[model samples]
Target: MTTQYAKPLPRVHDLNRAFFLGALDGRLVLQHCDACGHVWFPSAQSCPKCLSQEITWKPVSGRGRVWSWVVMHQRYIPAFADDLPYAVAFVELEEGPFMMTSIVGAEPEDLVCDMPVEVAFDQVTDEVALPKFRPVTGEAS
Candidate 1:
C-alpha cells in the first residue's frame, strides 16, 4: 500500500517570529495599499495591482464567510492520523482577503458555502500560531 501517512512539509516561514507574534497578540495584520485600498495576504511588500511600495499594515476584523471547502478522508501524514477526516476551506475575510485555512468548531456535515465564520487562533508551534475559523457567534438570521 502507498504511504497514507507521510510527514507534512515544514513551514517555509517562521510564523511565530513574524506573523504569529502579532496574530497571537490579537492583531490581524494585512498589507494594505495606500493607493487602491486593496489588501494583500501572506504579507506582500508591494501592491499586486499597482506595484506601489507605498503600503501600510493594518488590523482587520477576523470575520469571513466560507467561500469553498473540501473534506480530506485520507491521511497524508502520521501527525494527521487523529484528524483523518478534516475540512479545508477558503475563508473570504471581511476585508476582501481570501485565506486558505482549516475549518474548526463545526463538523463537515454542517459546513456550507457562504456560512459566516469568525477567526480563532491555533498555536502549532512555539512561534507559529495559525488563524483558524469557527462559526460566527450570535449569527444574524
Candidate 2:
C-alpha cells in the first residue's frame, strides 16, 4: 500500500486558537464586535468595523451560500496533488462573515454562485479538525 501524505494543517496561534478549538468541538464561530455588532472571520484581536478590542467568539448558524469558487486543477502543493480538481470556495455565512473553505461531497461542475451550503468537519489529525462545506439537503436555502 502507498503511504498517503496528509495535507497541511493550520497553525494554531493566540489570535486564531479559538477558531481551531471550536472546530474540534463541532462548533463554527466567528469574532463578533460587542460595540458595533459586527461579525468577522479568520479571527482577529479587534473589530475591523469599530476597531474595538472587545471581541468575542460567537457561534454562527453554519449556513452559508457559495459566494464564489475556483476549481484548482494545478498541484501547487505536493500534499494536495492527489486531490486535484477540488473546489475552493468563498462562503458567505448568514451572520455576514465570508470564510475561505473547501466544498466537499459534490462535483466541481455542480457548484454555482449562491448555492446553499452548511458546515461539515473533517478530522485531519487527532487534535485538529478542519471545517468544510457541503450542499444543504431537505432544507430551504
Candidate 3:
C-alpha cells in the first residue's frame, strides 16, 4: 500500500540517493567518513570535520530525541491544510546528526524538549519514503 503523496517530494540526487533509498527499505542511513570517523546526514561529498572524501552510507540506530519543535498553525503549504497545528520537530539522532522531521504516533501537546523518539518511515511512493519519528516505546528502533 502506497500513499497518494499529495505533498511535495524531495529531490533525489547522486549524493542523497542512498539515504532516500535506504528509508524506502525501512533503514536509516547517513554519510560516514572513513578517514575521520565522523557521521552526518543530508549527505555530503566530504566530511564536514576533515573534508575527507572517503565516505560511505551507513545505517544508524534510528534512535533520537526531540531537540525542539513548533506547531504549524498556518497552512503555509496548502496540501497540509488537513494537518494544520502539526508538530514539526528537529530530532537529534543518537548518531550525532540533526534531522528536521515530523513527530508522529503522538500529539503535539505531548511533545517536550529531549523526549526520546525513534524513526518511522512513511512510504509515499514506490521509490520514496519519508522518515518521521515517534515517541519511544518498548525497544523502539
lDDT of each: 0.78, 0.89, 0.92
Candidate 3 has an lDDT of: 0.92
Expressed as tens digits, the lDDT of each residue in 14-100 for candidate 2 is 899888889989999889999999999878889999899998898999999999999999999988888898999999999999999
lDDT of 2: 0.89
Tally clashing residue pairs in candidate 3: 0
lDDT of 3 by residue, 1-141 (tens): 665888999999988999998998999999999998999977888999999999989899999999999999989899999997899999999999999999999889989888899999988898899999999976433
- Ten contiguous residues minimizing lDDT sum, candidate 2: 1-10
Clash tally, candidates in order: 1, 0, 0
The TM-score obtained by model 2 is 0.93
RMSD of each: 5.4, 2.7, 2.1
The Cα RMSD of model 2 versus the native structure comes to 2.7
